[model samples]
Target: MKQIINTKFAKNIFLSALALFSTVTIMAQEEDTSSKFSLSGSIDAYYRTTFKDGGDATTATPTSFANQTGFALGMANLIGTYEMGKTGVVVDLVFGPRGTEATFNNDILNGVINQAYAYWNVSDKTTLTVGRFNTWVGYEVIAPAANFNYSVSYLFSNGPFSHLGAKADFALSDDVSLMLAITNPWDTNDISASGTYAVGGQLGVYGQFLNAYYDGGGQGGLGFEIDYTGGFDISEDFFFGINAAYNSNSETDSGFYGAAIYPQFTTSESFAIGLRGEYFAATQDGFDDVPVTALTLTGSFTKENLILKPEIRLDSFGSDNEPFLNSNGEATNSLSSFALAAIYSF
Candidate 1:
């Protein structure tokens, strides 16, 4: 019996050694065929102040982020990507005041993580991704380096930010694509306390996308939203972009609708100008609608990896509401502000 036990133990050890050898060999082969890992990110800062009769920074800006008075820190973004064979992973981290606000719904354990996801290319036409990712419904993203404007629009500010879910993307043809996702309720990053999930779909064709998201009713739930985002290039240096969205909550019978247009012209390789004109409104059950119009003009100047943007914005509200305080500390119907932002990307 002792000899038999000794022989069995030897066999087990040999099998383990063989398994380790096989794993190492496979890993080496994969490394040889994989693409190089990449690291990239950006840092940003800005100074903002209201003009004329507009109040301080906190009251003058009704939207989100970059609202602090005077000089302020934006955020530090760092993204690392690794691809091996048909699988890839992206780990994006953000730090600073802007990052804190953007990840307000994130899990306490992973506070600074903006996005962490893994994707698999199942075939030439299909890919599957899982984990936390930025929302696909809006025209603007959370990263400052990616947006042409320094401040966010009302439509992008009010919409969902990021989602934790699993998604499948399919390339229908050269010009058409489709994506479907199942996720926790809007902005519910870690887990759903209400034990509910949301569904999202996107249809893309010729640089245009139609997006839809629906969540049954739960904490931080966005009942349903239908959005259209697209852009067109009229000339070598001229471009036009548009975004329209409608959101509703069947449980409360309240919602909002808005539309915005973006027209940009490039004057030189290092300088460009753009404008954002938006009309937004909000409604509630048994209440009159509140309407507002905002116009923003921004100029972009670039030198190497650094970008500087000088922007001016005006927000006007319908006579029904006075949400701003003027220079004399009196309620007013409009507000105006100016902002200068600097961003460095690599």
Candidate 2:
């Protein structure tokens, strides 16, 4: 496992350097002075307090964000993009608990490089990308800067995070495109513990008011997952979105499936309110199927490059579900929490 991981790392670095050299050389011959390098990212932090009487309720929340009491650092992310004509590279690095949990699995290399990828435009309509990149599965992104709500949803929490491999993106038309990729096993952020790969991709359609996307893949002996996401601009000030996903692990003989909906309304240039409702379930032998449902209401206020998000969330478990602990340390079926977060982007 260690040898394979080392070799993969070396290969990734080698390919990135080689591609950069070749592309830059080609661009130099063409005398394309349009090449540019840019830097951007965000810094975020939050405070959370559970309404429960008993325990911290951090574990009861069952999702990302506000894991600790009082104040917590969400993350400090830095992304650099370099483009020289048809070739480009993106390097994203992150730190803090939010970054650690979102980008890394286990404790290895936590809060390091979230994604590092190189891309080449093979033609006007096709492009190739290699290295580690974020997954195209869910509607909400890993970055807080790209999300409407400050907290994460159950769907995003349970789905694949990122993949490391090679991918090809094809622009079929003005409003349609296709992506195909073969990547290391799910959530293998830096290395593949299984020493295997999986195939997956996304098919997307973009319209004036509606957009739809689907992505899925299966690992050799691990499992399979498929996710669908859609969004509609109901009006200039209102928007709606939905996400559904299913994943099955053959090794554990268990499966997980869920769906979520998002609705938002902008009342003014500085304030917007959004709501997320989600249902999630886990299936395994000896336990009856009971789904978990959650609803989150978020209000976002923006001032220049700074944004504040105040959110309230309630989660309920089915009658047979006992995943949460009550204030007195008793098994419970429901949990509620509140959080306030701030983000600065440039």
Q: Find the candidate with the highest lDDT and give its number.
A: 1
Candidate 2, residue 188: Cα displacement in angstroms equals 1.6
How does each model score on TM-score? 0.88, 0.85
- TM for candidate 1 is 0.88
**Lowest summed lDDT window (length 10), candidate 1:** 1-10
- Report lDDT per candidate: 0.84, 0.76
Backbone clashes, candidate 1 = 0
Worst 10 residues of 2 by lDDT: 208-217
Q: List the residue pairs that clash in candidate 2.
A: 54-327
- lDDT at residue 3 of model 1 (Cα atoms): 10
Q: Encode model 2's per-residue lDDT on 167-267: one tens digit a residue.
A: 88889999888888767667765655554556677887883222222222234244667788887999999999888887666565666789889999999
Instruction: Point out where model 1 deviates above 4 Å.
Output: 1-35, 54-58, 105-110, 286-288
